[model samples]
Target chain A: MKAPDFSYFEAQNIEDAIKYKSEDDEAVILAGGQSLLPALNMRLSSPSCLIDISKINNLNEIKIEGDFINIGALATHSDVMNNDLVHEKLPCLVDILKMVAHAAIRNKGTHGGSIAYGDPAAELPAFAVAMNAEIVLSGLSGQRIVNAKDFYLGLFETDLKSDEILIAIRYPLLDVNQHLIFDEVCRRHGDYAMAGLMAKVELDQSKINNLDLVYFATGDKPNVGQNTAKLVIDDGYDYEKLKKSLASEIDFAGDLNSSSEMKLHLATILINKILNKLER
Target chain B: MSAKNSVNISFSVNGENFDDVTVPTRQHLADYLRSQGLTGTHLGCEQGACGACTIEMDGVAVRSCLVLASQANGSSITTVEGFDDEVMQKVKNNFLKHNAFQCGFCSPGMLMTTKEIISSKKKLSRDEIRSEISGNYCRCTGYQSIVDAIEETINEIN
Candidate 1:
């Protein structure tokens, strides 16, 4: 059953969407409706009006404008999967996205919606943070860009104002010599992750030049599990250290499927596993 | 949230525009489309779990049960019935040959899903087909034939 209604305005565009925002502080912007509908049905949110922003054309843009690839917040997971530009630019995103919900859910769930909802178990923000992506948000106040690393303030929290909507996400294209890997564990495919890793490492002369490993479903927040990255980035970085570090990484979340101790065990094992595999 | 102040909602379903009567604000797209007598889009496990009420809105497939009719206003929606064209014919033949469905409760969802995959024109591998349709559940068929059916449809279409 649908939730009780208030008012509805099919916003003509970004400007129109913003207009509806002014009338109702309680107005919720409806994009793909994948997250919003579920949130409303769960009674997690009660907005007086729904500002349907699906009509805002430019908000869905996904293209290469130069050094950075701009992924519009409205871009669906399928849009990420299907686009040659996305595939060409960020295959790690593609890998992570493949594990995000199902074809049906991914077909309509928007990039912006996921980031805004800021579910700690979500894949995009972690990927965004790992990629050093920049978030762009707009409201009646106008637009602003936020780095993904800084955007996530806490679990299910971001530096987003109620009136502002995420406009786009921009990330640098991977340099040719760079390598990227995305891996996550879930009891079932398309469900939220039990644990996820988005890693990008730049290697030179069999030593680490830049080692960035981000862990999600392993923290209260969706941002990088900094300790895991710190373990590998220090001097004398190696598979041996990474393995030991993974074991020691704090708060490896435990629940129904796996225990906190087990996640730590897996992280330790995988850090060595991934780093070793990166060698050959 | 009352009758005195009503909201008009409209969108396309199965290739036809439906400027339907005012429904309560909370009415889900799945229920609204179903009540309007488009039964091809079935309802099962009203939550996102079972892909029973799947529809393509704005060229993307999603669970109708999870969407508000108001949110879908002005968007082009294609339900299972809308797939009664060539793509589905290919899908149905492939399913029949492969014995893709037994209970058939999942058939409508399967058809809607396979139609999207087949229409994509991409060379989808067995794993890709399996992953793409992972959301739809079929207790009886056990998925081998379904996988074969989709793979067959993909090969034939592409």
Candidate 2:
């Protein structure tokens, strides 16, 4: 299917993109175009204008800034996957990115675009929540930062306003004792996961000190298992007990492939899998 | 159509420069390439799922079906017809030797993605090769021959 006709404007910088977006209420920002183009081609979305921000300079940088790693919005998944900083500091991101789509898609798909698109099945958003990442948004009114947890509202929905542009994401550097584990169950290697989990664990003297578990594809948005995390910390890590408690914590949603019950089962399996890895 | 619905883009395709080419904003890169008679870039799925329309944009493999023609301005693109290097030649020969494709609709994308995997210079096992090319579906060959062909090419190159 061909995309519907729309006006296009190539913005030279962030300000230009903001200005162009401000002029039209129906204008949509074009990042890597990996997801948006597909939506457009399928006619699922049709906007009056497309603000192309791929050419914005300094909008694709992946660099370390003091205590956080600042990933520019336009940075492609390939760029993030191959960066030495991400490799050394956030290896879990590299691990999850390997399972994201394929090489061709990753070569063009942007990191911030994934978060902005707010697909509940996507791994990045769950990762952002697990790592306590901060999302930076810019609009005509200046800029504001939103925590990754609060940024996601519902299915394919985000706190991103139509006039605001996602500029960068800041992920705090992991402490020496902290470890991150991510795993997903999908039909194929690159397909969206039926259920996935990203866990950040910090162990103090062989006891779970801090545990954060974020599940994707099992709910409307990234489902933070706050109660489950509390259970693990309070009662220690017991697979049977934790599995029994998960059903009540997360309100699993059914999809075309997996039912809500099946998703809950898969989510429990992922939790057990991640916990085993953390114990090792 | 109004002038606002179209964009003038200049880009390079297979080492050939195209300047001031006007295209509809709705047209994707795959359609744009086909319009220029570069039909080798197939379009199995207009969406990014099927890798039949994969091409090299600035030395990276991407789904042309998902890239807008207007967004490709000033970029260098290489289609399956652009392969003339020794490595690509060897890859083609290996594909033929292994009978990697049947129906041949997926060959261009398979070749383009295989070229990328090989160029990565990583020592990939057969399982890794299969995983790397998972995006490019080959319904006819069942992917055994394709993996064999890519594995042979990597062994030869290494």
| Candidate 2 global CA lDDT score | 0.90
> Candidate 2 at residue B126, lDDT?
94
Model 2, docking class: medium
Q: Which regions of candidate 2 fall more than 4 Å away from where they truly are?
A: A236-244, B1-3
Candidate 2, residues B47-153: lDDT per residue as tens digits? 89989999999999999999999989999999999976999989989989988867999999999998899888988999999888899988685599899899999
* Candidate No. with top DockQ: 2
Q: List clashing residue pairs in candidate 2.
A: none
Listed for every candidate in order, the interface RMSD values in angstroms are 4.1, 3.3
Q: Which candidate is the best by TM-score?
A: 2
Give chain A TM for each model in order: 0.87, 0.95
What is the Cα-based lDDT of residue A102 in candidate 2? 92
Cα RMSD for predicted model 2? 1.9
Per-residue C-alpha lDDT of model 2 across residues A1-280, encoded as one tens digit per residue: 9888898888887887887787788888889988888888889998998888899899899999999999999999999998999898888888899989999999999999998988899999999999999999999899999999999999888998767999999999999888888889999899999999999999898788999999999999999988888887897667677777888887889999899988888887787788788777
